[model samples]
Target chain A: MITLTHVHKSFGDNHVLRGVSLHVPKGQSMVIIGGSGTGKSVTIKSVLGLVEPDSGRIEVDGREVHEGDRDAFLARFGMLFQGGALFDSLPVWQNVAFRLLRGALKRPKEEAREIAIDKLRRVGLRAAVADLFPSELSGGMQKRVGLARAIAADPEIIFFDEPTTGLDPIMAGVINELIREIVTEMGATTMTITHDMTSVRTIADRVAMLHDGVIQWEGPISEMDGADDPYLAQFIRGRADGPIEAVR
Target chain B: MSGLLSPVAALGRSMLALLAYVGRVAIFAGATVAHVFRPPWYWREFGWALMQIGWLSLPVVGMTALFTGGALALQIYDGGARFQAEFAVPSIVAIGMVRELGPVLGGLMVAARVASSIAAEIGTMKVTEQIDALVTLSTHPMKYLTVPRVVAATLAVPVLVAVGDSIGILGGYLVGVTRLDFNAAAYLKNTFDFLELWDVTSGLIKGAVFGFIVALCGCYFGMNSGRGAQGVGRATKSAVVTASVLIFAANYILTEVFFAA
Candidate 1:
């Protein structure tokens, strides 16, 4: 399980995260939804120790993650960045098997490549795509490759940042299905941040809405539509005329 | 009064932003350096950096040293003729090339080529989120990205400098024997006798330090770059300029330390 307690982060006068907290139980997919610049990314980064919180504690599997031990703490988790940050210099298989090809967890080159091809197959990609660079692939294919890399290590914790931000609706649906299938198969604890309602519906077991640097609403996905919170209602229905301002 | 005060405040704000960015870059660099000595060194990345920082740099380093050595011999022979010391050509050329010209020029050449390439490559990766992806994959970006390049530069620059020194001396030998009417054996003996261990060692040390600065500036600016084409371009330009200037500055300081009479 992943737990955050009373976390606060600020840059200059702007407090991006303010005394906020949330939790994701083991084998559950928790999706956080919020408007752009609403601290959703900051919250996830803080958990991963990418962003240090000024005051508060983050714990993964009951061990508190200290600021100094970020690498050790992060070893158990896998992340999917919003932009599908594939290495342009590397071919798809190398990008997928990047972790396995070197460092402490490294295997022989052929073994790592095989694992990469297997992960690619799991993400519904053809083996032929394995040798191509990221520049050659379309947007949706890149996302699939990113997903393949994320699950390649069989990490206990997975974080997805805007998994469907740039894809066509059909492609988005495909990615959503792949994420759902893989996360469920691995039984990995997952935290996903996105604005897409379809992704939230398809992937989230529990949903949290972030606004003004705090959790405005939190509940199971089934309860999201029926919830009476105005912020939740405004966000879910995508209405223009609501208490949530269109501009700051 | 209000206009002057507001402008002052804006200037202070910009200065503070710049300082903060520098601090962040320092912290990132420190983290990378620390991880370099740790257990999990990225060998694949290290191998790639060795190729990028060392092997590919050979042609530029060789060409620069060869031309500079030839030109120095010509200029020295011209100056020596005025003093009736034309026979001092080969000795002076070898000493000058080994001590200062070869390593400094080689470093600047590499700064122009490798530093900009690293910056543009890493900057493009940054804006595209490849570094972020590395982070999410349970791979420290520092270990995977910066450490390899830093190690490669530190280890490879000395090798490059040594090769350049040899090639440079050879260029001078060629010029001295062919154009200056000096005997081949005499030129070779002069070069061999005049060159000292300190001259070559000092040049190699300068090369290593310059290489570190080049890679550091490249990785620093690249990772700190903003997201877009404009940001990558700025990073590349700043990395090359900063590396070249730093290389020259370092050369002078090192020269002072090594040879001050």
Candidate 2:
């Protein structure tokens, strides 16, 4: 389980996250929907300590996120970045098995490779795709590779940052389905950030709409549609004029 | 009065900004050095860096040294001719190449090639969020990226300078014996005789220092790069420019320390 309390982050004049507090219970899929530059990425990054928050408390399993050993802390979680963020220098399998090839989670080369191929298969990728570089793969294939890597280590918590942003509708649907199926099968706690309403419908068990650096509304997916909040309604309906302005 | 004061204020601001930039680079270099001695050393990354920063730079460094040495030989022979000291050509060429030209030119060449490549590569990685991915994967980006490169360049560029020195002397020898019509054996003897152990060693030491500067500039500019393709382009340009300028400045200070009376 993960919890963020009163998280506030600002970049010079831009106040991104202002008193953002949220929780994702153990093994639940918490999808955060927000417009561009609403600090959705920064919120997750703050929890991961990639971006230091100006004022906040982030905890996993009731322990401070920044406390104790960093390597151990990070080992509990995996991330699938918006761009896939696969290392171009490495082959696909190496990227998938990166954590396994080095540091605390290190395994033998053959064993790591085997696991990478297995994860690739789980993501519907062929074993032969393992040796090719990330650039060699198609956009959908790259996203699949990123997904494979995120789940490769079988982490307790997984963060998907805009998982289907750049893919075509069909490919996006495939990724959304894969994410939904995988999250259910693994029973891992997940926090996904995206503006894709379709993805939210498909993957979210619980939904939270983030706006103006705060959680405007949050509840079960079923409640999201009929929520009385105008901001939530405008966002869900893709309206340009509403309580939430179209442009910032 | 306000107009006159504005220039002074601008100068003060520029000075402060320059100081801040230097302080940041110093901190980055210090952290990189600290990571070098820590455990979980990424030998694979270090080895790869060594190959890229060292082995791959040979062709450009060699060509630069060879041409410069040949040109130095010709100039020395022509100038010495007026002073009735044409015999100084071989010794001067050898001493100049080994002492100053070898490491400085080699370092500059590596800076242009390796520094630009490193800055672009790391800057792109930063933009793509691969750096954050490294962090989430339980790896320190500094350990995984900067330490290997800085250490590899520090250890490898001296060897490159040494190789460049020899090739450069060979270039001079070819010119002296054939073009300048000097006896081949005599030219070789004079080159060997004029070169001191300290001269070659001093250049190698400069090579190590220059190597450190080049890689540090690349990594520093890269890790601190702003976002997007334009940001990466700026980082690459800054890396090469900073590495080159620092190499020249370091070379001068080192020369003063080693050879000044």
| lDDT per residue as tens, model 1, A1-248 | 88888899998899988888898888999999999999999999888767789998888878877645665566678888888888888999999998888655779999999999999999989999999999999999998998888888788888999999989999999999989988888999999999999999999999999999989999999999999999989999998878899863
Error (Å) of candidate 1 at residue A157 is 2.3
**Model 1: per-residue lDDT, tens digit, B155-198?**
89889988998899889888888888899998889888887888
Global lDDT of each model? 0.88, 0.94
**What's the TM-score of chain B for every model shown?**
0.91, 0.99
Once fitted onto the true fold, the runs of candidate 1 whose alpha carbons sit more than 4 angstroms away are A67-72, A103-109, B1-34
Maximum-TM-score candidate: 2
Among residues 3 or more apart in sequence or in different chains, the pairs in candidate 2 whose N, CA or C atoms overlap within 3 Å are none
| Candidate 2 iRMSD in angstroms | 0.5
Specify the highest-DockQ model's number: 2
